[model samples]
Target: MSVPAVETAPLLNTPLYDLHLRLGARMVPFAGYAMPVQYPAGLLKEHLHTRAAAGLFDVSHMGQVALRAADVTEAARALEALVPADILGLKPGRQRYGLLTDARGGILDDLMVANLGDRLVLVVNAANKAADLAHLRAGLPDSVAVEELPRALLALQGPGAEAALARLAPEVAAMRFMDARVFDILGAACLVTRSGYTGEDGFEISTPEDAAAPIAEALLADPAVLPIGLGARDSLRLEAGLCLHGSDIDTTTSPVEAGLGWAISPARRRGGARPGGFPGAERILAEMEAGPARRRVGLLPEGRVPVRAGAALFAEGGETAIGHVTSGGFGPSLGAPVAMGYLPAGLAASGTRVFAEVRGQRLAAAVAPLPFVPAGFKRG
Candidate 1:
């Protein structure tokens, strides 16, 4: 995902900023907000702890918008005009992931759409929220209203997330992946989704800004939950083979090239009932059928040396470049260095050997299946 640069201007703080500081977090500027990069426990420990238990993340930096029309059908149809996803098919109380694409098929941002019974709630990247809102207003029918929610979002993620959250809200225990519901926790009303970026069984909670800190503290009070920061958050998502908007995908990168075709529902594809009306449909659909020139793939470096983003990749023994790493680092869960980048389609298959040029030296690497660590989502 495209992380906004740390600008020279003043930075904003989330509702949990004081709580993070109190917990001994190291704060840094991210996407115009002063965010916690890590706490006293460090990224490595935070990563492992989340996998074994639960991790509480302050994601108030994300944008939340409520899209309402005459009804759910109208709202979904209006949204479908901007994205390739089959929003109309999204059942109430469930969510689906999608990308906002420009006319040229390049990604503007990726987002999650949750059907909230009366209205559709969209959670978009903080950096692109403003643009995304404008895009929605311009493309959607006037009957559909786009209102940004002044809410704070938090992510409670990991294998123990369900249990930990259950302690406060038992109803959350029955929520499956992508399920959404409104419940009261610590006297605060929240829209909680059984979804997260960690590729784990988790929930993303949206609550009023005023109540965010209290709810977060309540969750952290559980033994299974610990505060995590952006550092571990990045490493965790990278290990799950999840793309970061600005780094792995951007306005120059199409969904097909990013290996996110799964986000395009069958109903939006050619020959389906609602085929190809969204932006860049022609080019995107063509690429989907003919295949993209370059495809994102997982890279496993041969040794201990970590290949970071922007590292050049070359064909075995050939100096000419084929692709570049978009996200890379040591995966705490895998206990090895893992990276993901784009490569020519033919060179993207698992077991395909490539070389990464690091520090003027070429190191052997292999194209491996994505999610170096298997995803633990509770799909059932």
Candidate 2:
């Protein structure tokens, strides 16, 4: 999807705005920020480079919020009331994906919750940060304080991320997926997490805003690490079957319907030890057991035509619409067009044939497993 153009001026800029311009980046408005959509190498090259080596991405527009209380247990329990994850059981220095939901079991936003020893750090979506902060403050007790950190976030992703990052912070090489730690790189303190959105072996570094440029430049100095922009980032995550906040998921999609039920811990499920204390727990838990009417599924279009978002889906040989694509694009790694959208439960199985209406033509598509390109996460 192309980044939307801004009609008005005065959009927020990240600390790397100057550096982006210097690198010949194509700037565009996204989530109220003038972010780099692509560099001179373009999205295709950037995407391919990340898959083969590493790509350094400036993701400072994302929100970094910290929750603190007298103890970690107290803070985790308070946070559990708002999200469906089992925060209280989260181990120290570990992170987990979670969803902030509404009372009706719809997703408000998806976020990353990391147990930062004495406190919890939340990485929320840029577009929903204000609302997510407000929600966090309103849900937590007085003892649990929610504070947004004035920091810049960077992601070093793909297969070569480990080698590039280890050159600066050698200890980071020991950490597995979802592990987090504080490290000093070039005398600058940074909180590094072994996680990212691209379904690759990578790390996300959160540092003081003032150090953003220096850190980014240091990472890009490596031959294997090239600066990546938002265009490739969106395509990478899309090919990984990850949901975009406002597009693939929103206030109307439930975690179960989105095929993110694994994010809801077993301990928080019905009949578990700490069952159903979050918002929409009743409906969420009920759906967990009974199943949702429709579910998100991966679609592999038969031909080279790329199906885009909002394209209607239809049943075989029937004009009646079954669903619509939420995120669709060409998967450079898979060498084919890939998409994801909601489909009836009965027709969501892999190998189930369907059709997508693109430009008045019904193109044949097949229901396939998610992550059009296999994930390369370092689980151990």
Candidate 3:
């Protein structure tokens, strides 16, 4: 479905607001809309539930756009020129996550692009939608049509997500991570993808805006699927070692520095030797080989005091500032405080002792391996 030309508020309201409220969701402002931060079940319960079963999330505010041309080959080249990912090698029905670079090669936004049977579908951060669309429209050839899907996106994430989705569409069971298809889900024609920001085995369903509520209701009817608010979503993704846009990464950062070098394909890296594709290509390519000055690293706080974003990470004596926390919270699954931040490369090794200055006191912390919780993504 084509998106309506309606002007949306910075705080856009999702079709599930009423249902979220009915379920006693704690509403908060996010991405220009009032959204549930947590449901009555609280963040702890919701976090655990999603890790153990299925957690339904309303992520419709995310921008869903399609770029189409007469042929997939032309479309792929145009996209590959803008993103570092191996878009040209993407098979039909498979998706790849990548970053949009500024002329200088700094990351503008992290996005997911899929080779739909006929076109390329892009899912981007809601906060960067307008700019992202403008960037694509400007860079893509005139022949390509950039259409934003008028749909409400839902995510059924966790270990039990497959079982919950199969109750409605058994075909979902066969999809591997990052594979998407237009399928009938709960009687509604929707796009279902086996992917999510959370590193769990899950599916993101994009239903026609109006049919969203009904499909969401149907999914929740199953005892295994519970409403998950943004709070839990943030925590879950953090535990999964996923970066949050605008925080962990932004225009000032490059994918290599953000620990997203895997997103760049060998073709792009080799292309860098010639140095002429997108913004920041020169610097980004150089960093790919020499390494970033500062890198995003995971930190495990020693005590229960949850270190919040913006907390300062200090060197041994807690005098020299080494890094700043970007995303931090209580990892319900890990049963401890976990955080991700950018630190000088010299201080980013595992087991390196660091201190986080929380309010007034210094809390002991250590450089830790990411995905504090194991990722359950379907590899095959």
Candidate 4:
């Protein structure tokens, strides 16, 4: 007997697309979805609003997957073996950021993992979702079940995020940073965690795909919450000293070189001890001890000129190219040109003077500590 041809389904839209259109959002294609790049209110206002008050962002494009195993301990072990983070030490209801690597130690993608009772949940970047799923499935045992959560994820972030979310989800008022819990908002159940990529005290709410419209409408009904776009999201994270997957760091960069060695635990670093599985162990462990030849650093431009990605950095003489900018832009919070790039280890000091070639002109720049704006996460 002949088998029937399977029909391919069209790309799914988030429940908020209609609302986005009604709000005059300039829709763009991103991660296989029609998303808003900016709205009628514009990007600058959105960026400033997010820093000063609350900005609601739809990050539902990110992949949400859960790993189910026999028990928590075994699940943690299996996961720890794959990533460098100390998952075994992760307390219940807490989350940690980690990277997945290939055998040669190249990054597959950076992700956030949460200990959700007996199962572990992961939120990975949208661009690398397919590759990440393939990587996970190949590495994990057959007994472990992987379930993808196709839902809308929203982030209400800024200094005033807690106050805004509390108006709708009162239980979030007492939630601690990195803690996850199930809460009801406007009569709809959702997974809310006091976490964000903007280095602020915020909440990431995962709601049913179908209920996204109602849930967003309920929260946005508040006067304080405004819709933000990707343009502002990049600037906000950059100002917060966060890394962008393909830009600031990529498959070519190791955690050590990316200045993320803190993600590795002591148990994983002990001499002669086998750290859990993933990829690039020998080189990664070695770089952890000896340090990387090039390190990611923060830069401040001297003049009114703003440096951009791929701009070449030079030593004091401005003749020899030493490094290049990965992510760069005018930081609205800093009110100046702030950027991040990889430079030779020797020149990666706080006070080291450097130069960047922008528009054929060499501009004086200095190495500055990351997080041009201080993080205001509500730790308690």
Candidate 5:
């Protein structure tokens, strides 16, 4: 089922909105835009198809921003002040995952930062792009320019993505994970990155807005490429244990507590040259030294029933609620129910038995390792 729109405000449409309709997509509202929830083939087939072959996703609604300082190094330093990652040390033609943190030590947003040859580019969530833009503008020095890019983003994912994209830009076949470069496709200058949200080997293509439809058309012309929608995207990311902002991690969750400690650069930690500059660095560094009070972990429900978000977690026989599910659904890949939630550090171990309160009944569940499905990134 697709998430419906209830907002009174008029919703926006992406560059591929018309193409989606033409392809028989079941349009639904997501992040204030009319997006496809699934195509004629439906969500289940789309999910399994992506795991086996290839799936094309329209993600143009996401925000694209470019940062420019006097020089590339200056731009990296300017961005380093805002994110936990070591942007100053980032090399050209590479990208890294970063977090925008608030003074309270909570994550404001999760984003991808790429070191373009002359500037740096950031890809932020659609729901938080406005706020993220405002934050960047206000925080960065006046000399630095924070400009939004009007580009369309598309994701081609699965084990076959490499071959599919290589047909158009042969150079992409040699790129490894997190590599970013520019290529000419259909007379358009495109920024191609070897990265994706799905736990599959894939590539994210950022191209001109006007060329989106035809580019999508060209890709769909291939038999292996199927149009996937938000429904399958959600289930795929869940099985991959990827956190969705506003659902799994939010203003109240810290990166350490959210099982994202690795995103923090070592140079930003205590006893380093550039230590303690970012917002909430004090608390974040402290949490690194002494573990957080609670931790995010995976949950496996014993039965076939789907456990959804907001279900409260409890001790097997205890009455008081300890935590609640942040993201949950039936894992199409596993043929079982999977979820993720926060719990006291003591109870966060794998195989720890717990119960979730669902409609007045306690269902048995156990803490499991994250990524119910293993990640298939081409790290080489």
Candidate 6:
């Protein structure tokens, strides 16, 4: 019997669609949106430019939500029930990484939670936005209001980000990593966060949809800034060793095993103020203390060939599979192929040798320290 073709929803366009075309970007469907995957400069050039200079990315497809309540603390506590984070302890004008966990302790999505004084704003992956909205509405009390923001988000990333941004809003020069502040850009209010997926010093700016194009144009006018697309964005994040929710992590992966235990706040851990309340707390806490059966680790392939996702990993010269590649690709920054995968804790140590099955060949790979490139965040 002929297999039936699966129907797909029509792709949506972000506010910068026209600008992307003007800049000769190759549009591709991602997360139900038509986003630019690369520009005329090609993926290699874009990736390197972002590392050496500022690269502006149109990330308007990301989900931005505002959680409001008469008392911000009340909303924080309400959100804390669904995530293993200490939202109550998150101070205003700051943002923290968080994971939405399932009842089984698997990750639902990874998000950035920022305290914007009057409310908590979350930036979640675009693919999970609908589910995240429904999740908040179902879990939060009536007192908490879950409102989606119609905003266009842009990321200006690289070692040169601050200088380029400071030209528009001079105050951004003083903002350190993870610091969130509100500023006006060319008469439009924009929420600026000193954070990004790339392990570089940068800012994610949330601006009104109507003003996005003008602000992007202003920044692009700077010689240091180039209009980057999703292709470079992915390779950049891969080099940084940051997990992509559906790939490096998923519904079956726990935060502890994903090398994200650091996202769990000390206040929410065992013996802390409020413990064992969040979803999957029992399994997650147990994994935190005893460690998981497998852990996420970085891998370096022996040759120039890439060991992509889904490649089964094996012990050196062994037949049985021990793990699988979660995410993998060439590292433009390192001039080599790099990958990340889950492996038994005993074999997860750096320098440990393993073999990845590719094209009927068993290629040797070595476990390496994460973040093929060093982080450039201005953490104080």
- TM-scores for every candidate against the unseen true structure: 0.97, 0.97, 0.95, 0.94, 0.97, 0.98
Residue pair clashes in candidate 2: none
Write candidate 5's Cα lDDT for 30-61 as tens digits: 99999999999989999999999999999998
Per-residue lDDT over 79-114 for candidate 3, one digit per residue giving the tens place of the 0 to 100 score = 877897778788898988988998766888999888
lDDT agreement with native, every candidate: 0.94, 0.93, 0.88, 0.85, 0.93, 0.95
Report the lDDT of model 6 for residue 340: 96
Residues 109-193, candidate 2: write the lDDT tens digits.
9999999889999999999999999999888999999999999999999999999999998999899999989999878899999
The candidate, 4 or 5, that scores higher on TM-score is: 5
Q: lDDT of model 4 at residue 54?
A: 88
Candidate of highest lDDT: 6
Tens digit per residue, CA lDDT, model 4, 208-246: 888888877776787888998888898899999899999
Candidate 2 stretches greater than 4 Å from native: 1-9
Candidate 6 lDDT, tens digit per residue, 1-380?
99999997899999999999999999999999999999999999999999999999999999999999998898999999999998999999999999999999999999999998899999999999999999999999999999999999999999999999999999999999999999999999999999998899999999999999999999999999999999899989999989999999999999999999998888888998998789999999999999999999999999999999999999987999999999998999989999999999999999999999999999999999988999999997
Q: Candidate 6 local accuracy as lDDT?
A: 0.95
Residue ranges of candidate 5 with Cα displaced over 4 Å: 1-7
Query: Which has the greatest TM-score?
Result: 6
Q: Cα lDDT for residue 258, model 6?
A: 96
C-alpha lDDT (0 to 100) for residue 197 of candidate 3 = 72
lDDT of 1 by residue, 1-380 (tens): 99998767799999999999999999999889999999999999999999999999999999999999889899999899899999999998999999999999999999999998789999999998989999999999989999999999999999999998998899998889899899998888999999999888899999999999888988888988999999999999999999999999998899999999999899999988899999999999999999999999999999998999999999988979999999999999988899999999999999999999999999999999988889898888
Clashes of each: 6, 0, 12, 2, 0, 0
